[model samples]
Target: MQIVVFGLNHNTAPVEIRERLFFAESQAPHLLKTLRDRGIRESAVLSTCNRTEVYFCTDNADSSLAAIKEVLEKHFDVDRRILEGYTYTFRDESSYKHLFLVASGLDSMVVGEPQILGQVKDAYRMAVHSNTTGYLLNKLFHKTFNVAKRVRSETRIGYNPVSISSMAIELSKRIFGELHNRKVLVIGAGEMSETALKHLKKEGLSNIFIINRTFGNAKKLAEDIAGIPYPFESMSDLLGQVDMVLASTGAEKPLIEAGLVLQIMKRRKNRPLFIVDIAMPRDVDPSVNNIENVYLYDIDDLKDLSQKHLSDRLKESELALGIIDGEVAAFSSWLRQSEKNPLIAYVIDKAEAIRVKEFRKASQKLKNADEETIRNIEALTKAIVNKLVHPHVTLIKQDSDREISETIKRLFTPDEEDEKDLDNRNEGQ
Candidate 1:
């Protein structure tokens, strides 16, 4: 079976296009089952804010890709022509490399952000829960996770801890000059919002308000940050009061629209309102950025910070890629060695059969021979068999290239039947 990754990421598609493709946590199992029904036996859908990719193990790559494309079109209600422009397909080594890069955060918009690793782990768990992962995917993801951990630990890729949250804080500082004592309102108490709020708190921003669909979660985050907890219904009231807004809600539609921002700006009397939305299916609308005294930045807008430190990040990326390449070579070698097992097994079995048959024939012919003589003949035959097969064993165990293995296969009898044919010719001789 071949490893294939069919994906479209932030580089290929804009947020407007990607949001429509993002899969909810609850929808993962159903999606996996549908893929299985479509003859994609072992499959995983890694649907994050910036990308939605399907990784699968299949023998018929072309047919499976066609089927996956059909499902993507029907499921996302998008035309094939449009999806085709933004999508990419990878196979074998390229596919594995992409996976390793993604797990290590090298492929993310914010390189080495430290969140993509967890996102990948979550996607893997979903595949495991749905029973959509098999031998190949299980091994591949485990190794990918290990590689990611190694990159994080061994390299300086994540040393500075630059995430979207930190970027949001930087953007806020740029806008307001200082975050100290600024009343910041966080919409949604999810991980992203919590992280942004955490950074804001560290920046000495004191007045914070957290609103969530679930008041309990909002209260918990509010207590953690020593901020105020408010019901999500008070979002409009709090919007006008706060100097900045950090939104990371899971809402499918736009929660902060142009109309809402227009009203809020009017209430603030044109006081500047900076909003950073790190949500996947964006919490704020694109048109809201045009509002008077209202500045809005989405996940894509936050990636501008990565360019500022490109030189240092590039150095880290080179190191991380070196690690990935080493892992890929190791995996390839293991696969090659494993592929030769059947041939190795057959050759050994054939040699053993010959050794036993010759020993039996000698014992019958030398019945009048003394016990010690019989033992000597047996030991001699055993030694001869070992010497004869030793070179072949070395050839099999050597971690050579595919060409060498192919040559070895051709040089030896490929199957038991071929060995038997050679044995018959020797018997006739």
Candidate 2:
């Protein structure tokens, strides 16, 4: 089966197009099942703020891509012309490399961000849980995750922790010119929200409010940041008081609706409120941006700050890319060896059978020969067999086409009918 990836990312499509195509984690299993039912052997769907990729194993990559495009066009209500223009298809070895790059954060909007690795791991686990993957895909993910870990450990890719959270904080600073006394409201007390809170507290932003569905989590995060913990029910009340809102919740639906923001705006006397929604499925309703004096930015909107962060670490990114290249090459070598296993085994079996028969016959003829002499003869014959089989071994190990290996196998496979004919001719003679 061939590996294939068909999808679009931030570079290929704008956020409006991306949002329509985003798949929540809960939706991944159904998408994978549908792809399998449509004849894909194995499938995984990874939809984050920056990308939505469908990685699959299939016999015919071209046909699979065509079918996938149809599903995407219909599912997202996207025009076929636009979808074709925005989507890209990677096939065979490149598909595997693309996944590796993604997991390693080389393909992320924020290069070297640690969150993409977790996102990739989640996608792989979900695919396995759905039974939409088998040996090849499982191996692919394991190798990629290892590569990611290597890149993280061996290089300084994740050293600075320039995550999406950091970028949001930077953007908020750009808007307000300072963060020291800026009143901030952080929703969802999750890791991403905690990350933002860390940056905010480090920047000396003391007036902060933490709200989460789980009160305990919010209380703990508030304690850590030295902020006030409010229940999730008081979000609207806090909205009017805060200058900036960072929402990183797991809510499937938009939590901060336009009407709520409008009410909060009236309560605040039309004071400007900046909102950063870093959740994958977006916590704030995008329509909230329409309200006067309210600005909304989602995860994708953080790309500018991320790009700036990436540029600052281009040297380390180069080192990380070198690591990725080496890992890809290693995986390619393993793949070549795996594909050639059967042919190599068959060749060895044929040579050993002939070698053993010839050795036995020679030993029988030389009845008086000592064991040491027999050992020498056996070594000589083994050397001869090794010389004869060396070319086939080299051919199998190379990155050449499978047809070459098949041709070599055919040469080694004895023709039964020809052998029988030769035996009959010899008897007649």
Which is the leading candidate under lDDT?
A: 1
**Candidate 2 segments whose C-alpha is farther than 4 A from its true place:** 163-195, 198-309, 341-429
Q: What is the C-alpha lDDT of each candidate?
A: 0.83, 0.81
Error of 2 at 185 (Å): 11
Evaluate residue 283 in candidate 1 and report its C-alpha lDDT on the 0 to 100 scale.
Answer: 91
Output the TM-score of candidate 1. Answer: 0.54
lDDT by residue (tens digit), candidate 2, 1-429: 578899899989999888888989998888888788887867888999999999987767788888888877776787998778788888877888899889988888767888899999999989966778754676789899999999889877766545676766666776787888889998999888776677778887868899899999999988987889998898888998989998998999999899888888999999899999989899999989888888898887676656655676666878888888888888888767655464564566567656767787899999999999988998899899889998888878773686996677667768876446434533533
lDDT value for model 1: 0.83
Instruction: Return model 2's CA RMSD, one decimal.
Output: 16.9
Residue 105 of model 1, lDDT score: 88
lDDT of 1 by residue, 281-325 (tens): 999999988877788988887676555455477688998899999
